[model samples]
Every structure is written in structure tokens, then in C-alpha cells.
Target: MRYGMAIDTKKCVGCSDCVVACQTENNVPHGYSRDWIAETVEGTYPDLAMEIRSERCNHCDNTPCVRTCPTGASHVTEGGIVKVTHEECIGCGACIESCPYDARYFHPDGYVDKCTFCDHRVKNGQDPACVSVCPTHCMYFGDLDDPNSEVSKKVATRKTKVLAPEAGTKPQIFYLI
Candidate 1:
């Protein structure tokens, strides 16, 4: 099962609710965040187009983070969730350097940390904190391998894009435009 997330950019309001939820639920340090809202504005003046998205680890199928980890701390878990084993991490920052999405951060406790898609919560049949608390309900998460899953259906039906696709990471996060 390839777990993934589909975020509707048209529905997102740049409220940062998902960011706050991720921090509170993950117990992230005050200065750090596992996810954040990114906004892009293009064109000129009144003709400008704006896209706001909640961004985090892409959980790539061809993860450069996992490939660059000298200590094997960065690894892909079940359902394509990329995670760092804090105990095994040597704080080398290799994974952080390799991530095209700039998702990994060095923790205060001297290890790397990033989004997990709230694997603990997912295992309990609950959504990720970010997805659960999105006020606009723009986020959808489920097994992408299952054609009937919400995420899969959304990806199949909507116009979507993945960040840094040229990097060839095969990122699982989809931005529905």
C-alpha cells in the first residue's frame, strides 16, 4: 500500500491550520515545524494567480534521503512513509542535504526530524493531524495503491502536480490544482 496525500490548492486558504496542527500533535520544538504553508503569486497586478499549499516531506519512492544516509537512519517504512530512526541517526545531515523538498530539519535533540504523515495516527485508523485539522477540508490522505481510496481517486480525477518532479524522486504528495 502506497500511502499518499492530495491537497487541493484551490480550496486551501493559507490559514496555516495544518502547520499548527502538525506542530501540536507532533510535539515539535517551538522554533521548528514539520509542515508549512507555501504561497506563490504569479502574473501582474490584477491578473495575478495565487497558489497556497501545505508542504512537507514528499515520502518519495526513490528517496535521496534514504540513499544518502550513511547510518541508515533515514528509511522508508510501510505504506511509503519515509522516517528517520532517531536512535540510529548520527546527525550527519546527509539526508537533509539530499532532500529536494528541504523537508528534513536537525532537531534540538541532535537528530533529524520531519513529517511522518503521522504514521502512529494512521495506524490507528485516523488521519494525519494536518489533514484532520484542515478547516477547509482540502487535504485527502489514503493508500494511493488502492484505486478506491480517496487519495487515489482524487489524484486520478484532478489536475495535480508534485514538487520538484525533475528530481525523479517519485514523490507521493500531490498538489491538486
Candidate 2:
């Protein structure tokens, strides 16, 4: 099954709850964000507008991280989550540099780290930590291939965009742009 996210940028309040939830749930180290918000400034003065985007691993079907992992640590799960075998990781940081969106980061243990879409929770039949904790309900997670799922319906009815589509990564993540 293809998995992806539907993020409502307009509803996003720039709150960092999603970031903290991911870090806490995954035991991600302090000072490193597995997923986080980015702000872009536009207009000026009274007309200034801030765009908030919650970013993580896109879990691209054609993932560059998986391709560049020399030791074969990073790969896609059957559910479409980009996952890394921490023990097999050699702290090479190839994945970090490969991400076109600057989504990946180096963990304290030197392994490349990014969002797993909370595979641990998904495996347990739960939503991703970030999606579960989002107060504004800005994030939606579900099987992208299922026509009845919210994610699939939203992508079908609305125009959505992913970061760096030019990379040809075929990212499953979508934004309600």
C-alpha cells in the first residue's frame, strides 16, 4: 500500500507540537529534528505573511536515500515508509546530503536520520506521532492507494504539491496547497 501525508498549510498554526511529538516518540536526540516546521517570509510590513510547512522524509517511491545508502541501511518498507537500519548505518551522512528538501539530518550516533512516518506506531495499528499530536488537525495519514481513504480523496479533489518534484523522487507526501 502506498502511504502519504496530506498537510493543510492554511490550517497550520506554526505550532511545533508535531515536531516535539516525533522527537519524543522516536527517542530522537535533542537539537536534532526528525521532522520540523519551516517558515518562509513574504510580502512586507503590514502585508507580511508567513508560510509554515511541516517537513519530514517524503518516503519517495523512488527514494534517493535508499539508492545512495552504500551499506544498504536505508530502504523503503512494504508500506512505503523510508526506513533506515540504525545498526547497519555507518554514520556516512549520504542520505542527509542527498535529500533535495534538506529533510534528513545526522543523529548523535552519526547515522543519518529522518522521519519514518512512525513505522513503529503504524506497525502497532496507530497513526504517526506527529499526525496524532497535531492540535489543528492539519496532518492526515492513510493509504494513498485506497480510494475511500481521506488521503486519496483529498489528493483527488484538491491540487497538492510536494517539495522538489523536479528531483523525480515521486514523493508520496502531498500538501493541500
Candidate whose lDDT is highest: 1
Each candidate: RMSD: 0.6, 1.4
User: How accurate locally, in lDDT, is each candidate?
Assistant: 0.96, 0.87
For residues 1-177, what per-residue lDDT tens digits would candidate 1 score against the true structure?
999999999999999999999999999999999999999999999999999999999999999999999989888999999999999999998898999999999999999999999999999999999999999999999999899999999999999999989999999999999
Residue 72 in model 2: shift from native, Å? 0.5
RMSD of 2: 1.4
State the lDDT at 51 in candidate 1.
97
Strongest candidate by TM-score = 1
- TM-score of each prediction: 0.99, 0.93
Pairs of colliding residues, candidate 1: none
